[model samples]
Target chain A: MKSAFTRNRPLATAVTALVGLPLLLAGCGASSGSAGSENVTEISVMDYYNNEPDKSFIGDALNSCAAEAGVTLKRETVPGKSLISKVLQQSSSKTLPDVLMLDNPDLQQIAATGALAPLSDFKVSTEDFAPGVLSAGTYKDKVYGLAPTVNTIALFYNKDILAKAGVTPPATWDELEAAAAKLTEGDQYGLAFNANPTYEGTWQFLPLMWSNGGDEKNINTPETTQALQLWTDLVKDGSVSSSALNWTQADVNDQFLAGKAAMMVNGPWQIPALSKQPSLQYGVVKIPVREAGQTAVAPLGGEVWTVPQTGNKARQAKAAEIVSCLNSDKNQMSMAKARNTIPSKTSLAETFAKENPKLATFTELVKTARARTGQLGDGWPAQATKIYTAIQAALTGSASPGDALKQAQGQ
Target chain B: MSLAADLSPSKAQSRQHGPAVDQAPLVPRRRNRHRKERLFQWLFLVPAVVYMALFFGYPVVKNVIMSFQDYTTATFFTGEAPWVGVQNYVTVLSSSLFSTSLLNTALFTIGSILGQFVIGLALAIFFQRKFPLNGILRSLLLLPWLLPLIVSSAVWRWILDKDSGALNRFLGDLNIIETGVPWLTSTSLALIAVVGVNIWIGIPFNLTILYGGLQEIPDELYEAGSLDGATGWKAFRYITWPMLKPVVSVVLVLGVVYTLKVLDIILGLTNGGPANSTQTIATQSYALSFQEFKFGEGAALGNVLVIISLVFAVLYLRASRRAVDE
Candidate 1:
């Protein structure tokens, strides 16, 4: 056996060399790509509007804006959830699109990475934009992104169901609880809202938490506990189904459309789907506050367009031009009208609300809507995780609201 | 065929071809021909070895290195991961949720493997009997295995939904239960329900592999056992069990390894939620890396899982070796 192995030593050596050759080659290879050309005729744009109407609406707006700026557009739309992962991959490969759209809350996190150029770098004005929307796009006092339109969650109730139950639109937490209980019937709950273990859950809870004077920076306070207690009481009262722990915002909307839920807390994005059900008469109102006089403070929900640092001066300037033009007064109104969202600029709010009365509540809410990252900045992601974790723990009855908050914060 | 002949290739060749091809002047040519034959034999194995190295070995090594470094969202852009020297491991091991996750993983794997093996073995043995349409029925049993895990998870999610689930509806119709059972919503029951769904998904794979193993054991052993007053339980213990030990170990080890890293089913069903009753190490690792963006801690936890799998693999290999030797 020893003699045979000695005889095959040369063959073994050759095989070993062959196996190592590819690994060495793989290590030496560098993945790089050149930026869009200086004399750019067409600039690449990336956004998360892969769904139907928003896809076409954003496409038309981009085409019009590109024409206004004297350039053609190359568009790439990904699913809403995967937009951040795609941006990270593109950022690392130095292949970030010239123009990119980010969910408002994520803008601060991405901007902190220095992958986005400040709008002021290309002489784009941030003046007259809603304070909340501007705060969402700003990092360290520099505005890195701008939005044409924005949205926020609100109380959407079935008009037919409310009339049948002899219940009015709830204006306070007590009224909401009573109304939800009154509407509860066989196979149907009085209320539906997402409290799933995701950022969306945290987003939905912001209205209650902010209205009750809860702050994300210090989540385990009395105000936050009271907000969580409201959710727990609803679920405990059997007005909100135990399955709200698993439902997404879309799932909540489905429950409402099916008449399994008399009311749902959702955003204007559900309007198109709601319109598809012609017989379902739904009316929109602000999410209930903890008290009658308290203002309903919903978290702002929108996508902001920005120019990424693509290492090409001419293309960056042109990308900025398209970004600015997409947010111009005329384009903002048109895009907001096309999509079921409110204009981000305060100047355009009155006109947009007058034009699209269905979105008036959202428009009014947008004025007081707070950016999720307003306090935490880049730290918002961690806080959001804690918020959702606590919500899940409290709703599941595994921990009290206070204990859940403590556990969620890793104390 | 002899060891001496193999060591001395020229002697074997001369004996085979009548000593004519072993000429002294043509010795270099003969050596070149032998080397070419060995190279061709090696060429067949090179592709498989290269694939394993690239796909499996590289990732394992990369994960270990990442576990020791502070790999985060910034690392993807800056390409700078500061080495933290086991701090990630410390954090993972010391976290309060670690114990809960470790216990959950053990229960999930053991529960799934035990349920699948017992039911699968029973079906495999039952299918061994000759019957009409037996072949067709056995082939159809593999359909569950063929379906993607995510599809199974989604179907199970609807079936186990609290208010309007089919399971509750069926039970309610029979007056077996008044209200719906909170299968995925309650902390105490979610883990068991998840394990039950996983067992259903795993049954087909175990049954097919065990059935193949059973067929390899000749009928003569059973006949011999029956002659010696061994039948049914006695026959299986004295004959089938000993012969099927190797295959059983393989099934169990593979099942444990696969179960240890299950992510999608848990994510789709409970998302490691309802107060984290279903939070296993694999799902928690995913949450850390993707949800919390803490890749280093995720890698640390992943390495822990790999070590656990390696332990089971080593024990099974040793047991199999002893079984072969005996």
Candidate 2:
């Protein structure tokens, strides 16, 4: 046995060397191949519009933008949840796509990594963009990305159910609670909003938290607790289903569409699906504030286009042109109309709201919408996790709203 | 000439058919042939060794190295992960969630293994009897194992949904309760619900292995036990159990190891939610790395899990060895 072991040592070393050689060579090859010629033709783009109508709608927009930029398009669409991880992987491999689309909240984190080149470097104009949109795409005051269209959560009420219950569309917390209590009956929940243990839950809770004067930087304060209390009371009173603790925003939309929920807090992205039910008349309103006079501040939701540092200067420049074209007023208007989103430009949004009155509330909400990462920057995900954790704790009856927030903040 | 005489019949026949070798070099020729034979044996093992090193060894070593570094999202782009020694382990072990996750991992593994094994063994023994359509029934039992875990979890999610799930609807019809049971929603019940789904997924695997073990038990032992007034319960105790001990140890060890790293079912069903009632070390590690981009902490937790699995594996080796000795 000893002799046999000694005999195999050389073979083992040979195997290790053989296995490692390709990996080392491959790394060198990847780095060297990225610095290509100046006459770039097919610029690659990556985004997370992997699902339906939005996929085709965004595809057409990108193809047209590529045409305008005098380059053929090579586009890759991933599922929304996987986009960030994919970006990190590609960044490490030095194969990051020329044009990258990130969820606005994620722009700061990616920008912090220096993987994204600031759009200003390519002479892309940020003029006429909404403050919230600009803030979402900005890191350390340098604009790294831009969203052509943006969206925010709002109160989506089922018209027939609200009419049947004789409850008005709520505009304040008091009215909302009263209206929800009145509408809840038998098998139907009065309101549906996700409080799941995910970032989506934090996004849904932001309208209430921000409008109530809550700050993510210091969530243990009274204002955030009050917002959490509102969520807790609704679940406790059975106005909202206890199952909201597990429901995603998509699930809340489903509950509303099935008439199991009289109202839901969701984004306008649900409009296409809701429109399919022609008989189901639904109206959108800004998410209610704590009091009558306070403004409703919803968190901005959209995908921002940016140029990634792919080591090819010409391609990066061409990619920035496509991003600028996508955010052009004409393209923004067309994309917003097709995608049921609010245009990022303040003037275009006003004209868009005038043309499509159905999106007026969303347009109005966008004016005062806040970017989640505006205050926390790359640190936003940690705070977002804490917020959702607190929501789950309070809603699950494990702790009081204040205690849950305090405990989460302490973590 | 003497070496040729010592050769096996086949080798000697081949040598006779080939060109004749010089008598003076016979000893050296034999030693050269022996060395070539040894090299050929090692060459045959190359693929398996390379595969194990590349897949299992590389990832485990990489995770260990990452655990000592301040690896994060920035590290991906910058390629600079400063070594932090034991700081990651210290943080991960000291966190409030660590104890909860440890306790939850223990409960999840014990509950799943106990439920799956007992149920599996019973089904395996029951199927030992002669019954019509027995083969088809046993094959049907393997369906749960055949389905992808994600697919199974998705189906179970619908079945266990609070308001409109099939389980609630069925229970409602039977007047089990007035309201829907919040199977996947309640903090108190979410863990159990996740465990139940895991158990269902694991049953087929346990049953298939235990059933094969049971088939290997000689019927003659049972026949002799019956003569000694040991029929049903007595026969199983005296004949089947002692013989099935080795397989039982294997099944339990494998089940525990698999259950310790369960992520997908818990993720798909609840995402370690309802206030993290279902959060195990595996899911928490996943959240740390992918969700929070805290790769260092995630690798630390993952290493802790690997140590636990290694402990079980050691015990399994000892137990199997004891079985062999017996």
Identify the candidate with maximal DockQ: 2
Clashing pairs in 2: none
Give the alpha carbon lDDT tens digit for every residue of A1-411 in model 2: 644564466467657766876885576565536557988889988999998889999999999999998999988999988999999988898889999999998999999988999999999999999999999999999999999999999999999999987889999999999999999998899999999998999999999999999999999999999999999999999999988988888889999999999999999999988999998999999888999999889899998999998878889899999999999999999999999999999988778999999899999989888999999998998899999999999999999999999999999
Chain B TM-score, model 1, reads: 0.87
The positional error of residue B159 in candidate 1, measured at the CA in angstroms, is: 1.0
| Candidate 2: fraction of native contacts reproduced | 0.61
| Local accuracy of candidate 1 as per-residue lDDT tens digits, B200-254 | 9889989998999899899998898898999999988988888888889889988
TM-score of 1: 0.91
Model 2, residue B101: distance off in Å is 0.9
lDDT of 2 by residue, B1-326 (tens): 22233334434433453233323557778778667645544554454465667678899999999999999888999999999999999999998889989999999999999999999999999999999999999999999999999999989988999999999999999998789999999988999999899988889999999999999988888888888899988888878899999989988998888999999999999999999899999999999998888999999999999999999988888887777787
Off by over 4 Å in 1: A1-37, B1-50, B319-326
Candidate 2 Cα outliers beyond 4 Å, as residue runs: A1-32, B1-25, B323-326
For candidate 1, the share of real interface contacts preserved is 0.41
Docking class of 1: acceptable
